[model samples]
Target: SQTIHQWPATLVQPVGSPLSLECTVEGTSNPNLYWYRQAAGRGLQLLFYSVGIGQISSEVPQNLSASRPQDRQFILSSKKLLLSDSGFYLCAWSPLGGRQPQHFGDGTRLSIL
Candidate 1:
């Protein structure tokens, strides 16, 4: 089956604490990966994207950052957490050159206290 991996599925973090979220894609080769954040009543915000290994582009100037550590692995991290950073984090992948539609994994719900 096609699958995308993301964790932790839920996170409760104190303000100012560090944060790390990981995502990996399976059953696909060299997919274009994307990181997105969805807040209540808001549209999906594209945070980062990678078309190839180590080729990352940021779409927003938020406090979060993303990295492509491997061909199928992506990591989102922050040295300090903020209340505004809390949201549903989604990891999605699509075939390159916009040939196919994107698919998303179960998102990680993050809350800051």
Candidate 2:
């Protein structure tokens, strides 16, 4: 059985601060990882994705960046967060070849003050 974990279920930070969010998966290997953000009333927007270790694909141009250093660990980082960076961040995983639907972890609600 595969499961995903994300930390700091809720976060509050001042504008122009640094941000780091981590996600890890268990019971799977080399699964595709994705980072998505959902704004207050907007649909989900893909931030980044990884097919394997050290391989990442960015879907949007923003203050966010993603890295996959290990087989099951994905990290999202921002050196200088912006007010627009506040949103619900989600980490998801899927099987290879885009054949499986992604399973998402309970997201982190981020608020910029």
Candidate 3:
């Protein structure tokens, strides 16, 4: 089983500021890493996914970008933050074949100040 860990449980940033959120998976190799965001009552939106190092897939055209630095380490970053970007950010990991359930981290609650 893989355990995902996300940092900075909560964050408050001013508009136009930069943001970086990280997620790491332990106990797994070559896992699929994912970044997701959830609004107040909306469903989870997939932001990015990585199948291997240096390979990233974006689901939307926003001010955010994701990177897979290591095989089990994934990062989410933005050069400029926006008010609409405030939400609960999450990181998840699953097996490569898409047959297993994903394990999510505690998540980070981001608020635009």
Candidate 4:
């Protein structure tokens, strides 16, 4: 079975500050990875997706970027934070191919001050 580890379960940052959140998967190879944000009691907003290392697709126009530096690692970064960016950020992975159920990690709650 695969496991994802996401760090900093809670974060508080001021607007215009830089941010970096990381996620790494274990016991899986070449899995599809994703990042999304969800406001409390709202639908998910996809941020980024990766099929493999160095392959990333942005799902929304925002101040954030994602990178897959290794097969099992994904990182989300922002050069500047926005007030609207406060939400629940999640890391998830699915087995290769399509239509598979994605497994999510404990998400990070970001608050922009």
User: TM-score of each candidate?
Assistant: 0.95, 0.97, 0.97, 0.97
| Per-residue alpha-carbon lDDT of candidate 1 for residues 1-113, written as tens digits (9 for 90 to 100) | 66899998999999999999999999888899999999988899999999999899999998888999898998999999999999999999998865689899899999999
Per-residue lDDT of model 2, residues 2-96, tens digit only: 99999879999999899999999999988999999999898999999999999999999888899998999999999989999999999999998
- Which residue pairs show collisions in model 3? none
The residue-by-residue lDDT of candidate 3 on 1-113, one tens digit each, is 55789998999999999999999999989998899999999899999999899999999999999999899999999999999999999999999976789999999999998
Candidate lDDT scores, in order, read 0.92, 0.94, 0.94, 0.95
RMSD of 3: 0.8
**Candidate achieving the largest lDDT:** 4
Residue 29, model 1: lDDT of 84
- Clash count, one per candidate: 0, 0, 0, 0
CA shift of 103, model 2, Å: 0.3
RMSD of each: 1.0, 0.7, 0.8, 0.7
Q: Which 10-residue window in model 4 sums to the lowest lDDT?
A: 96-105
